[model samples]
Target: YLNSFVDNIDEMKEKERYLMEELKNQENNFLGIKSICSNKVDRVEEISRLKIEMNRLGIFLKNNQGLNDFSIDDIQNKIKEIEEYYVSDEEINNLQNKINEFKSKIAYPIIEGVFGILEENFSIIDKKYEEAIYSSMGSRSKFLVVKNEKIGNELLSSNNSSISIIPLNKIKPKIVPGDILRNVRQLGGIPITELINFDEEVSKAMEFVFNGYFLFENKENARKACYDYKVIGVTLDGTLYDPKGTLCGGKIICKNIIFRRKDLLELEQSFKEKKENKRIYEKEKYNLNELKSKICNLREIKKAKNDIQIIENSIKFLNKLIESKVDYSSELSSLRQNIVKKIREKEEFLRRKNVLETEIFELKNKIKSKKEDEKNILKKILQLEGFRRQSEIKISKKSIGEREEESLELKRKHLLQNILKSKSKISKLRELLKEFKSGKNENSKSHLPVQFQEISDVLDDFKLSSNIFNVDLKIFDVKKEDELKKELFSVRKEIEMSKNIKK
Candidate 1:
């Protein structure tokens, strides 16, 4: 019974060792799957970043053109959300170990086997995203074949029958070997590949290099690895890879290799049927690339036209201002010149009139001095001849003298009133004479003489008229000036119109 216990202990030890090895294997397999998923996730993220950068460039271009439709802030928020799916390798390894530990806890072999199958199945499905990235790059050729659209409509429909040839050089694929697929790689990232459908009628295949590398990198490696990717060659028997199509990923099979049936058994399964979906897939990819380029060019053209129109409008507005200002220019110049000439003439006339008035004032002072001397001499002679009043006169002389003095005062007062009245008449006559001399006489009394007699008659007539209406004679001159201004305005308008017609 003790020997049986020892045998049982040995069996348990063997089983434990086996379980440990299985656990280790499971861990390694999960790690490998995680690496593949990580690579896919990287590819998805990198492509997304590049698309974002392109969109940013477009936004900057619009901003430079003064358009304000897009917001960089909003785009940055979206980018932050996309970043959430990224996972570190260390974290993935930790998760893998946990899954392995959970799987090892099953007691029955059947249960363990079932769990292993499940794990393997999940891992395969996860690997499909990586396969998508490889397929997208591999089947992408300048030359592509159209496929039937029967399988879930993943390929083109039969109603449309054509192949599309895109020059690979024109396609802007943003991937290099180092850039991994992020969806398969990152746990929560978007799928690394996009499937598109094509109309076979409008599709055609062509031969060209696909440039999928940094422009400034080393020439040989960048060009050969990226631009010179090869496609499958067609054979006489209508077989793609039977002649030579690479079954294993990332290697190209160009020349036909004959192999025995035993060698064929050793080789991996050839996915010739899957190539049909790939062909339509490639055509759809080329179409999408062409469409994107057309869209970019159209946006650029629209921006250019908008800029041109703005400049054109500014030029037109300035031209209109110039055209409108031109019509007023000639009249403005003539009026300015006439004003200057009149100012100069008025200045000269004022200088001459001042000198003439000084001479006239001196002559009037001399005449007044002569009249005063004569009156003084007559008063002295009358004092020496007092024979009428000295003696016998004491009596009746007082009444006769009083009466005569009263009569003399009355006569003097009448003469003085007449002289004062003559002053206004003389002033008006002198003003008329001055205006005539200055060549600015616009008075209606132009036929009247410059002498005092005619001036007195005109002044008397003005006084009589003013008394009758209780109006000042001076106001008549202001009324005449207003009428002259109205006449001048009408004349100016006529002259301007005539000048425009001549022009």
Candidate 2:
């Protein structure tokens, strides 16, 4: 029984040694897993924050995608349509060209150079026969009447001057004899002098255009008057009979020069409209292009979703891996508890063995003393009876139980074993408890590692990206499109840098 007990103690010692090794291994494994969990937690949280930002940016892009005002192509087409009437396509090819280019295409207003038109100063008293004078005057009616000869010289000196200007100071007035006028009246002629609605101030320019023409009722009367009076005669039909026997008729444009101003004013108004339309289209195109750029950013974000999801999956796997390690830790702690139990059991057995060995030593000494006493007593008896006697007795111990090692030595070993086992259990249990609490707390993801500056920096980056996504871009216009594109490129580079850091 003693040998078997010793063998049992040796077996427990061997088991304890093996279990201690396993405890060390388990501790290492637990710590390694814990470190991984801690490290990955920050990364996962960073990515999660990034994920939310990405989603928000994506939503922003989607909402902005609602209805872009105009595409660049559409804007160009609209600009072309608006300006085509005024500016030719060849002129439009130069983006610098503007609606002012169209002004050069329309005719200049005659009013620009002259003080007044010749016809504006005159109105025949007989409104019914007004056509005779204007038709006979023809284009001569449109001659510009300048304020003076100097003004006329200035007009003629201008590089773009093409209209004829008559200076009031330089014009000569023609007079008709009284008898010729009376004869034309007798021939049914309305005298040109009676028809002239001229003020003395502008009468010279007026008479220069209308003085020689007289209106008779018909071509026959006009011819008779021109032959009899040897002066120019005009009918209401605009047929002119010249004293030189030349007849002119059948052509009329009474209001041609008057329409010049109207045509130019209309063209100017239309050009302004085209310019305004072009401006509107340009602004719309700028907004549309900005929208397109944001949508492109949205596309990049969607593209990165796959990578984000993979990281999320890694986090899930890591969390599960951490949870799975819980069982191993439990086994390790159980082994430690068992080792303590075995140590206690071994201590108890050793205490009993020590006590039995001490008792056995006392018993052996008493047996030896009794043997001496009995031999002496028997010697006395032999002497008295003239007889001799001899006695022999042996006490044996089993080989494994033979007390080769001292009781003090065994006590020392037992005390040392107790101290080592107790201390190891206490420290290990403390460490194991710490690991459990850490793992449990972090498993729920409620823990924030505020101590890590890297995480703080990552959060700042996310906020910056968020701000970029939410930035109001309406302040910029078409002129600032290039600046916006540069900013976009820089933001993309920052995002890429952040991605690299996370990886």
Candidate 3:
């Protein structure tokens, strides 16, 4: 994130420079217009001083000129007048002594003193200049150019060999204010260096005239020496002359070392072929972002769906519980009815057993009464027998025999009646006991009883059947609906992505 912001700083700096320059140019233009409206040509020196004063104002203003309004003809005429002012005899005579004093102060004089050096040191070189075969070289270095080949040979013959010689055309045209061209000698007794620091000269000259800079090349030779330094070219008037081939639609390099205009166009054209590929990459990135968002949305939707499913499941389970409760209640009702019926039947059996118990009680009492009567009869018989024995003793055999016969008949009749009564009571008791035992076992109006275990088994079977038949109707098509919703969402997502790509 910070990279984009930092990268913008350099671009902002460049734009700032451009806008500053433009503003400076406007200020200068207005200043020039004021100067013109005032009609003050005499204030040219003040105007020139303004250029230097406003240097910080920037390049744009400098190029447009500051506080110095003049037509094209006016500029030409002014330059011509300044040239004449320096050469006129009255000014020259007044400055002659100062010029000589100035000459002693500087080791190498300015561009004007270049001629003085040639005249004093090189009379033969001057002849070559007048003949257009040579020119007096102007440089910070003390050197001379001899355009004639014969003059070069003459200098060599004179054995003033400390002065080097070379062909004039070998010199690059754009010489800087201080650089020198020379042919200096070494131990070989032959002149070697025909050019010296001529490249710096061309650069300054280009900057002065073109209001820009240049980089130059022999293309092949530049690989050595200052390997990164490319040569530059200029004209005598300080105008930057194009390198021989570039103006003719040939290759050229800019400050950034990129080729200018035509070459840049070609490079841009090559990039156009990859445009489709870049578009595809951008589309894929957009799709990835979209898909990530969709995934997040789907997650939310899925959670909602799961919540719904959970609620449905809970409802269904609750419904099942309610149905089970209802079925259980129904079974309990049926069990209650069966218990009531059994209770009624038990009551009837209890009533019958109570009647049998009453009969058994009466039979027991009757048997006890019969045994008491028999005991009494036995006692009376014993008393009668004893009385008969005593009488027999007194009244001989006839009296005893009559008494024994009467007693024997009475005993036989009584014994037979008592035996019949005892048998009838015993039979009655046995029948009552049988009836009570039968009553104890009977249930639900049956001769046989219903077991408790049988009733429990019937209830369980009924409950199971009821539970199997129960259903929860709320979630009939929930799963199918959820799946369909998911599928439709996916399809819509794909369609949106397709539209985004087209856009």
Candidate 4:
């Protein structure tokens, strides 16, 4: 999210730069027109300025085509109407505005420069290639082209999520094989890109989008171009055909979106007509001082006065557009900065949140392990008690004669007394015996405590004696009350020893 915000800021900076340059250009244009006239107007200089502006306008119209519907008669009639001076002041003012409006429509949006505009606005398409251009370029014709991937990414990162940009640095022209081009042309098709005119700077972008397709004169030819040549193309009627048996086309709403060839020719024709108009006025120029000395015709005076009004109104209009872009640019900057700070703060918060979650997970795992350890320890102690009880019963069952049994028991007690007294020794005894019985490892038997080892040796001797005692038990006399008391005392001693081991 923060990366996205940083991208937005970079885009805002570009927009700001574009707007500032636009502001400078508009201001210069406003001042340049103002400079053409002074307190005492020079008619020749005014005509010269008009010629220069017209030439500049002509260059601009090449990239940004003029309206084809606007007839040359409108301008010619405006000029002829001006001679009468009988036309309303309002009408003349509107006519002059009509002349400037061509630029007015195209300039302000670019001056604002909040979004990237396409280098080719389908203005490159002439009438013959409209369908092919549409099929080849499609919605991508509306895609904004930028200087590099960084600029494209930055612009896309802004709040306007719906738009896309093509970075010139990232795209390459699609290469069509020479044989394919020759074959296509032989089939009465021309590569659509050939008909469209675009700048060399954007040639890569243009061809990358458009060069793959061809324009055929009709649907039948277009179908053949698709089937035989295995290439895509469209008919002049706007039907699209692809080699994959795809056929899809309909009229795309192209008013203001596309410019036909005639639109461009008409724009050139306007400049030519205006040039002729300027030439007719050019022959009438008199010496500057001499013209100033004698009063000029009322019609010529009206024309100069009218031109001044138009320029002044244009300056006013430009000032408004300048303020609008400046205001939007400032707001956009502040918005981007705030978003940057916000994203940074949120990212820091996310980092801390992750750390806390990790700690919580580790703590939970530790608690669960300790619980399992506790249950295992309790199970081991219960098992040890059961083994002790079973061993006592086995030894008692082998006892027959009191004298021999008492002697054996005393000897075993003396040896085990010190071992049982040491709780750590008892623990080691259990550990070693468990390891040894399970065949855990070679080291278990060798590592037993010395006292526990002596007890083990004595138990082995008792096991050997028990076998011999079983044979003698049938012949031995059984002592009753006195034996019971001795047995109870021995059990108490064993209980006390077990308690010491527990500690």
- State every prediction's TM-score relative to the real structure: 0.13, 0.29, 0.15, 0.31
Query: Residue by residue across 1-503, what tens digits does model 4's lDDT show?
Result: 43454555455556556555655555555454345332223534455566565555455445333333344445445445444333344644554555455444332123222233443333544766555566666778667766788766666675354776677888877788888889888888888778887666667777888776888887777787788878887777667787888887887654454332333445656555655555544443333223332223333434455665565565454455444434544544555555555555545545654555566567678879999999999999999999999998877776645667686666545433432343343454555555655678667545544535554454454345445444233333234323433543453354345336435
Q: Any residue pairs clashing in model 3, and if so which?
A: 133-147, 174-201, 174-202, 175-201, 176-201, 216-231
Give stretches of model 1 more than 4 Å off: 1-281, 326-503
What's the distance in Å from true for residue 231, model 2?
0.9
lDDT for each of the candidates? 0.40, 0.59, 0.38, 0.57
Error of 4 at 59 (Å): 59
Ranking of predictions according to TM-score: 4, 2, 3, 1
Candidate 4: stretches off by over 4 Å: 1-126, 159-161, 256-503
Number of clashes found in candidate 4: 0
Which candidate tops TM-score?
Answer: 4
What is the descending lDDT order? 2, 4, 1, 3
On lDDT, the leading prediction is 2
State the lDDT of candidate 1 residue by residue for 1-503, as single tens digits: 43454455455556556555655555554443334234434534544554565556556566555423434454445444434443445754555554445435422122111111111111113332333323333444222222222221322232154433232223333432323322112322122222222222222221112122111112233223222333222211212221133333343432132222222222212223233334545555555454454455556656655655544543453344334534334544554555455455545545554554555566567668978988888887787667556644765788888897676566445433543455554455455555544557656234433353554454464445435444333323455435433543443354344336435
Off by over 4 Å in 2: 1-113, 124-127, 159-161, 256-503
